[model samples]
Target: MKHKQAGLSLIGLLIVAVLLAFVFLIGMRTVPVVTEYFAVKKIIHAIAASNPSMDETTADIRRDFDKRASAEYVDSVTGQDLAVYKHGGQFEIGIEYSRKIPIVANVSLLLEFQTDAKSNGGR
Candidate 1:
């Protein structure tokens, strides 16, 4: 009589464990970038939603961004990093930046984020 293997062997389990660990490490390294991206989106939306600022000057807009940056915990990009544009009679804030994350001795990850915040409820 012949029987099939019922479960994973030691080598099979070890391979699986190693793969899981590699994934976990990559996730750990990327977590901060993901979190900060959302934080940036939130800050942009908040600033864009402020209706009165639609007509505000660039200096005022930058000032508000600086304030929001502190409150929102967005450390990567500053108000000076923002580019303001007027689109379709509404104000838009555009940001383009990149972050480099170290993965290992010779490997790294580069993430680039490009986003715009429009005051007219457009993403």
Candidate 2:
């Protein structure tokens, strides 16, 4: 009688390890994007809370949002704009940010996100 042990082959183990490594890398890369998105959301909420007097246009809010985000990430934040609209007495403010993620030389991932908040004259 003879007994033999079976185990994962080198290639099989290597493949599993590579797959795990890839998942970890993707998660790491996504963390910053998620963080930036949340930060933008917070900024939008703050702007809405402040409830700056509604002006003839949304330029002031846009500039203020850009200034805040820019100060937070002077070197990273790019493409700042505002998407604003009003509904009767309520106003909705949307802060948008477009950023480029460098994946390789001259290759980037264009990531953009917007956050919207509504204000009812501080009610």
Candidate 3:
């Protein structure tokens, strides 16, 4: 007589579960930074849109950005790190920053993001 087999043996299921947990751990560690990046971008866009005249000096813009960033709890990048410029009578703001996240012991992840926003222009 012959016997039949089923899908996903106990060992296989355990392995899959472990892999999933590892991935979830990584996600849990990285999600906050990613969301913060988006928040920073949104803030920049909002500032650009609000000051369409592009007459604000770089210092003024940086101060405004610092205020908003602090309110939003953005610590990775600061207003001083921003490249504030005007071109063709339009205001543009750009930021470059890196975040290092620790996954497991002695193993870490490094993420680098570069984002820019223009006055009254879609990012």
Q: Encode model 1's per-residue lDDT on 17-109: one tens digit a residue.
A: 999998999999889888988888788777888753445777788888889888878889998998988766688887889999888898999
By TM-score rank, best first, the candidates go: 3, 1, 2
Instruction: Estimate every model's Cα lDDT from 0 to 1.
Output: 0.83, 0.72, 0.88
Candidate 3 local distance difference test against the native = 0.88
Better of 1 and 2 by TM-score: 1
Model 1 pairs in collision: none
Q: How many clashes in each candidate?
A: 0, 0, 0
Taking all chains together, each candidate's TM-score versus the true structure is 0.86, 0.71, 0.88
Best by lDDT: 3
User: Per-residue CA lDDT of candidate 3, range 14-117, in tens?
Assistant: 99999999999999999999999999998888888786565567888889989999999999888899998888777888999999999999999999998888
Model 2 residue 119 CA deviation (Å) reads 1.2
Ranked candidates (lDDT, high to low): 3, 1, 2
At residue 25, candidate 1 shows an lDDT of 92
